[model samples]
Target: MKSPQDWPEPIVRVQSLSDSGISTIPNKYVKPPIERPSLSNSFNNDINIPTIDFLGLFTSDGNNYANKSIIYEQISEACRNWGFFQVVNHGVPPELMDEAREVWREFFHHPMDVKQTYANTPKTYEGYGSRLGVEKGAILDWSDYYFLHYLPCSLKVHNKWPAFPLSLRKVIEEYSKQVVKFCGRLMKILSSNLGLKEDVLQNAFGGDRDIGACLRVNFYPKCPQPDLTLGLSPHSDPGGMTILLPDQHVAGLQVRRDGHWITVKPASHAFIVNIGDQIQVLSNAIYKSVEHRVIVNSAEERVSLAFFYNPKSDLLIEPVKELVTKQNPPLYPPRTFDEYRLYMRTKGPQGKSQLGESDKSQDEK
Candidate 1:
């Protein structure tokens, strides 16, 4: 009987893509870390991430569209005004978030020698990396992470998961399942708000074709000078939606709102959610994928789990015609996430993954 921690290692087999017979996965759009001249006196240290009470948003004691009315209002505000919000009572249990974090810490805390076995290097983009903005001459961001592409379960190959946690596999597997459900529920809410059937967006994902999910477990090691380090660079997520669960009490997440950056204060039990590019296209760009970034602290390191929810690579993403009436013509042409991803890869690490403005600019004479 093979246990979760002691199962025989399975050889990772990946198809060769280039001249050299090595496996390659899609790498992230890298960007140089932005540096500030000094920890300024005027810079905002007072801002925080917006918080939304699910109970307040979905008032249970309502009828017919009552529940939806509350959700619609808050969702619209979060999307249009703030572009980000911390979601509580999201239906994903708090216990699950806790378990996922425990497993992540276990793997990260493994000795450097044990962790290095998964070193991604230049060949395979599937393993591990320290710091962001890895390109030469780019200022590095202060963060360490383990990246995994999970979905189509077969595609999931264990790299260097911790060997001691008894419930590691069960916990992660269950958590991933729950995330898929959360993504579905959110799509339906957005769809209804977009004047489409509840299933409009969900159907765009195709019947049980399995959505794409990319997970990054980040460990922000304590910095000697937190003012000099960034847990994550200022960038937009490149998927349909991003689900984040941060350290319980620490405050580091922030989103660019209005013209200012607002902090995303950590809540006791919540999953901070942010929309991404695919949804922007499907929703006619009305619900935007906001620009968000992270800041580090000088005292303690922060740990976060970011799950990127995306449609299948082959799905055609076009603005729903139903949402575009006489007043609102289709904002974007049909395109696939795969193509957008290719364009971004070639564009190099600018962190601007959205194509809305770029497409519009090209359309103009």
Candidate 2:
């Protein structure tokens, strides 16, 4: 699909409104009545996503094997049942996580002109952005974000990353390195969980060197009418999986479960992990990409770092040969990651068709 030269309309930074002290949000940011975050019991639920400890699961020397079997099943269960989980005792240092998140927070709080230098376009979406999709007049989310690539080496341009925070580039470089390493470990776990060789999933993702990994740092500004609009629209991630370092001070991410929306409680010094559509495709639906959205808080602004690990853009991804059987066959047609995401970027990821009619996002009202 060919992309437009630029955004369909002029971009408006959501953080500006929060700073301007507006009592009410712009009409363009309002969601349909059915899509708004409601406080009634019918909409919110008491359920919480699973939290798994990685304390003994993975070590530099080698797997404990004893602890490996236990935590392995926990991750498998979480992927099958909830498509989401929180992981603690992960190898990434706590100090680094805090530093990585704080640097982005400081960048968002900077003056508009400073952040605008890297303003992004619909073509690549590689720098600062305020909205998703180029759909003109689309109702927008109450957030601003910075998107940058990390994998494929060709695309990891240090100059493109924010520089004023001084330490921002260094932190992101180290942060991406650690997170990608963990993702590789998780891929092995997923393969083992599916009774396949440890490298099956990794190989399917174009091997480690050719993988697609990127980061989108979302800054959700406090909104006056939080209930009337969402910080992000409802959708499953289009990539393989997401490793999110959430804002511990404020809770806003919500996962849909049994037709109810459940807010996630951040685990201290932990990373939230969730399955995405690519894995679901590769798993042949043994796991799923859970539909999730972020709600804005009127009392507090929030920032999250979402690291997406995906297959190489041009590699055709399909259900693994092992997962396919005469009983099930291939549920989804083979499609490249490039072909899959083009639909999302143009049609928007708000429960729209991803790869075809077979891969439509859940449209639960």
Which prediction has the highest lDDT against the true structure? 2
- lDDT (10s digit) by residue, model 1, range 1-365: 11122112222211111112323221221232333313322136766556666664434554636666766778877775555778888778888899899788787666666666776533223556653322344445557677777775666775444344667767877888898787777777777777788888877766455677778788776544455545665556666888998888677776655545566778787888888778878888688776666776656667898887887877888887777878988877888877665554333223344564532231231
Task: Write down the lDDT that model 2 would get.
Answer: 0.88
Q: Which lDDT value does model 2 have at 46?
A: 54
lDDT of 2 by residue, 1-365 (tens): 78677999988999999999999999999998888887422354456788999997766546587777789999999999889999999999999999999999999988899899999998888999998888999999999999999998999998899996999999999999999999999999999999999999999999989999999999999899998999988788888999999999999998877667789989898899999889999999898888888998889999999999999999999999999999989889998888777777876766525744322234332
Regions of model 1 farther than 4 Å from truth: 1-50, 55-65, 121-124, 131-134, 158-164, 325-327, 342-353, 356-365
Clashing pairs in 2: none
Q: Which residue pairs overlap in candidate 1's backbone?
A: 30-349, 48-263, 48-264, 49-263, 49-264, 49-265
Whole-model Cα lDDT of every candidate shown, in order: 0.64, 0.88
Alpha carbon deviation, residue 121, candidate 1 (Å): 4.8
- TM-score of every prediction relative to native: 0.78, 0.95
Give RMSD to native, each candidate.
9.1, 2.2
